[model samples]
Target: MIGFSILNTINTDNDDLSGLNEIPFTVSYVTSIHRAQGLEYKNVKLVITDDDKTNMTHDIFYTAITRAKENLEIFWNAETQKFVIDNFEEQTQKWNKEIALINAIKNNK
Candidate 1:
């Protein structure tokens, strides 16, 4: 489990109630990339196991990398590393092309 503390301020029209507060929470150490979408964290650790290679996609990898706001660590075996290197550029270009097509369609509508 990972623990987090966040400071928040409380405000009210009443003169006696405005103050700073601390909120604490705990979260699991591991979560799926899909489940983590639209959330950002101070640090992220991504592990790609041999079993993951078969189902891994560029979008999933991209999402995991982007989730880290300040630091990111990635762990994978040599085979997974090679898989990323071999497909990275091609996949990026393909996604870019798809994005352009989507934008063109939206502009025409």
Candidate 2:
């Protein structure tokens, strides 16, 4: 059993605490990413399981990364890492070729 105690006044009869003053809480850090959106943090570590990665999209990744104010670390398996690295390299090569073409056109004019 967790060794945590609290002194809180709970009213099961009324939804509104009309005459009751209480501090009710048991644990923390139990929240979903959807609920965490629009909130910022100094550092964010996202742990992605195989199941989660299967449904992850760019928009979701963007949202998760933007939540971090300074640092963002994504923890994933080898499969996800390989996918990220391969896609990144492919996109980088395409951009490099496009930039080179643009420079050549400008120099010829």
Best by lDDT: 1
Displacement of the residue 72 alpha carbon in candidate 2, Å: 1.3
Per-residue lDDT for 4-104 in model 2, tens only? 33334574765554555445554435345787799988778888777776556555766777888998888999998667556556767888999999999
lDDT of 1: 0.81
TM-score of each: 0.56, 0.48
Question: Distance from true position, residue 8, model 1, in Å?
Answer: 44
Which runs of model 2 end up more than 4 angstroms from their true locations? 1-30, 84-109
Query: Which clashing pairs does model 1 show?
Result: none
Off by over 4 Å in 1: 1-28, 89-109
lDDT (10s digit) by residue, model 1, range 1-109 = 4445433445445555335445556664778899999999898999988888766778788899999999999999999988876677777888899999999999999
Q: What is the lDDT of residue 2 in candidate 1?
A: 45
> Which predicted model would earn the best TM-score?
1
